[model samples]
Target: MSDAQTDPPRQRRERKQNADKRRRQVLDATYRSIVSNGLQRTTLATVAAEAGLSQGVAVFYFKSKKGLLSEALRDLYLIYEAHWQEAVEAAGDDPAAQLVALVKADFDPKICNPAILSVWFAFWGEQKFTPQYGEITREFDDNRQRAIQGICARMLPDDPEHAADVADWVDTLTDGYWQNLHLFPASYSNRRACNSTLRALAALMPEYRDQLTPAD
Candidate 1:
């Protein structure tokens, strides 16, 4: 018999909520551990210690280090995807506004902080050895690319090839900015990176230059 079957409805709801809270705590600790210790050095014990939970509890929730790390990657992707999706939605139906929103979303503090970037690169560094990491990252990349491509297509209806190319360039530009921000934080600000990306986008698609002007 399951715990839910034996427990009262209120008790079951509380139990599930508590379980979710603990699980999220573990994942947050996992990100900190990755940022502080690197991916290979992060152990279940370390994460549990960081979360103020037991190693056994970590195992119970995630089964193994691989399971824990995979879920962490998925969680990060979900956070990233949600930010961009919300940005696009808030930009209304204008493709230009949506494109700008998507670009700006990459620099949002919640998704682009040093700890999150560290965790992301840590997973990316292990993609060759970890197939699931590659799978998760590929999905992330594909989804973003499709969104960019769709927006570009809407803005440049007669030139589908150019739309695709601009989408690819925008993705690459955002990635380059992330790499620089991660490695050269002392010299780079998110503002500069975002403005530079917008400039590059305007140069690529001069038709949208008015709409793609970098905010001051």
Candidate 2:
């Protein structure tokens, strides 16, 4: 192949990798900035400093604080969704196992890291500044709720309505634990949280008690 043809494809790949790297760097810095300074206090300059990149570069990529925050929120939601989805898939075909995996995934270190969790709550707590935050989070919640509801339906073949109720309870318990883990790290244990969630699952669906026991 001609150098021009071969070089263009290689250069394009390199450029894409570099662009992706820079975007991830900024997004990570955004998470750290929000965790450290709170969402309202986070700015392009703060993120740039955290990223060791110039504010101009941050601006070039994300345009403004609003844009940056929206992207960061979306990125974090996608990461969370991906983790649980992967966990559920790994749990095989048993609906009970899938439900257990879903609860455990919420506390998985990859998605439950304090810094990332704080960034989520920061965006969640801010109701007025950006509607994008609400939109992104609602999408995440809706999808996760559907996944849980589906699993509950499979587990509770006789009563579909009760399945939904159990799903709601499961979501509420996991969310409460997440808040506890974020707000009261002094007394919170991830293993305990997972155990508590599994216990609640067992109570909700006693028939599946054997399957709901915490694996850890």
Candidate 3:
């Protein structure tokens, strides 16, 4: 009832909001720094500068360089996963359409923007040295593979093994696209990559192609 007690509660709420804001700012700054300078050159000071905060402030939220990097990678994974989910949903009830949507989603510039792509490569480059990086990368890979497998299974129920084969095929194609995008810009245009993936999927399920339509 007293001013002191009420003030403490109000202050706590304000602090919580401020902390959340700061955490987001730090994560975003870390992402941008990794995108611009590559993860090897990204530092707390550099990220802090990007966030318009002091290095101490960045450390206050993330604790250490490794912690900052991990959180940034987690954020990136979450965003990527969400995009995949949306793509799956947009595919509607048709399994064939869903497969196409899945392939198209990967190359969508809105979802796989340059910054996100750069940060992804940076994380991939660091996975060799960081155990957590490997763990997170595997988690993403497994989840994606499973999702693709599930879609294939629904589309080709009569051939369960074919579903897995499709999943593996798509995975390989996706990786190839990523590599080409990183290495050869002209050869891996987004439209070309997406179309290639769709064609590959169509080849895998030629019988279902006529039934499938472009996802809304």
Candidate 4:
């Protein structure tokens, strides 16, 4: 019958949608579990329970606890990448503007939070066991440094060597601030951290100092 024929296709479509939904659900649950329980205590059982899914289903989706946590890290990395990419585009062609935008993107409340920061630190700690990368490839950190270096070179055409050094400082400073957030969540404020970064950057890139550190 027509109803029977259409029902199978509808069910197939639904099955695909459900599969995607369940995968996302599990990853989100895994993130929450890691945030709440810490990587040491988080397990397949806990994530599955948080997701309201069976351990068997979690295993089928991700294959193992490692797989589950890997996917969660991947999700966070993509969000981080997209935020900065969009920030750069919005800042247009000015290297100084773009650099500032990219730096500020890290402190955006949407992605920068205690929960997410904790998850990042968790994967970092497990770097010995896992590949320790998400959507960001092994070269992403290098690429970002290169991008910042290039920007500084453009801004200060005379001192390319110092520009590269400044890029390294920026990269390390950014990482340190994020680690601070993870390490001292109670005392750290994203706004305060970002302001400190902006001040340091403004000092480092003096040509763009006033512009980078706008009044008020």
Candidate 5:
């Protein structure tokens, strides 16, 4: 194909790339706005300004404020899903190590830093906003819980019921630790938050705590 024939495709590709870039720019701005202004006050105009674009651009992509917020929530959930999936895969075949990797992934500052957690709590505190968001977490957590439960069962073959309970306990403790991070970030840095979860995991399964904790 000559340049004349190929130029149109190139132009189309550039437009698509710019559109994707803008979409992410707007979403990131939305998150920053929510963090700075609180979700209730984060207007589309504010998001556009934060993104260094006009409100018309944001409207062009998301159509409305709800759409932008919904996409942000979906992106957040996908990020968390990827982190844990990679962690589990990297743990090789040891169920104990895999479980520990899963726990550590939850508190990884790259994905679950205080700023990010605050953004999540903003969406979580507003039930009205949640309905607008997709159900990305439902199946994600279900599959994760099942994976952990199966790992626990394997580790404690003699006591399957206790293993099941251990899985549930770990998730509950994880939630508590997350809540602590959101509710008390000054006192509970991501490191501290993760350690709290690890400590609880230790108390629950002492046999694998050493494997879970890294050597200094």
Candidate 6:
């Protein structure tokens, strides 16, 4: 056998790892392109250029522009999920505290960037025409709603219905923030939004109202 064919199995495994790493690098570059230029302008060649890889090498991993976009969206969701987990953990033991922490993290500059937000909105706009995008978007939205519902359940055990209601209400408020961030930056101040959301949820559950109130 030729020297290339004589390589050990471990060498083959290492090659696979390298390939996967390159694929991820390409995905990250594609994400940045989509964020900066929008999906319409993010061609495969553009992503390849961003990744500093040859176009043929990018095509080997992604196959098509759509495939690259799909992978990039999935990667973005995974990154956000990790951030969400960290925010939840930092909130400590109190469910009310957790709820407030989660809301604040949504608008925290460290956690939320214009590029990330722009990519999300772009994917959301394309969801209507793209079945894969639609499915992923629905899953993402449902997961977020479920997280809020779980937090509400913990905070308002006696009033389960109120828990769901409060969760939905908070979702509405956060969604509004996403819509008006550029138009009314001051209107969506993280601290004020968090307090207002907590207050609104508290009104729905008198049993937890005092617990959710900020300390003087």
Give the number of the best model, judged by lDDT: 1
Q: Give TM-scores for every candidate, taking all chains together and pairing residue i with residue i.
A: 0.97, 0.94, 0.88, 0.86, 0.86, 0.82
| TM-score, prediction 4 | 0.86
lDDT of 3 by residue, 129-174 (tens): 9999999888888898888888889878889988888879987998
lDDT, candidate 5, equals: 0.83
> Considering every candidate listed, which one attains the maximal TM-score?
1
Superposed model 1: Cα runs more than 4 Å off: none
Summarize candidate 2's per-residue lDDT along 35-102 as a digit string, tens digits. 88998899999999999999998998999999999998889888889999999999999999999888
Runs in model 4 deviating more than 4 A are 1-14, 132-139
* CA lDDT, every model vs. true structure: 0.92, 0.89, 0.82, 0.82, 0.83, 0.79
Q: Is candidate 3 or candidate 5 better by TM-score?
A: 3
Clashes of 4: 0
Please provide, for model 1 over 1-216, each residue's C-alpha lDDT reduced to its tens digit, 9 standing for 90 to 100. Answer: 987799899998998899999999999999999988899999999999999999999999999999999999999999889989999999999999999999899998878878888988889889999999999989888998888889999999999999889989998998999999999999887888888999988988898898998967
Name the better of 2 and 4 by lDDT: 2
Q: Tens digit of lDDT per residue, candidate 4, span 18-80?
A: 999999899899889988899979999999999999999899998987677777777777777
Q: Look at candidate 5 and give me any clashing residue pairs.
A: none
Which lDDT tens digits does candidate 5 get at residues 1-216?
776466788797887899999999999999999999999899899999999999999999989988888788888777788889899899999988888788889888888777888898888788545655436556567877888898899888888988999999888988888888888777787777677777777777778778766543
TM-score of 5: 0.86
How far off is residue 52 in model 3, in Å? 0.6
Ranking by lDDT: 1, 2, 5, 3, 4, 6
Candidate 6 TM-score to native:
0.82
Q: Can you give the lDDT of residue 4 in candidate 3? A: 47
**What's the residue-level lDDT of 185 in candidate 5?**
74
lDDT of 6: 0.79
- In terms of lDDT, the poorest run of 10 residues in model 3 is 207-216
User: RMSD (Cα, Å) of candidate 1?
Assistant: 1.1
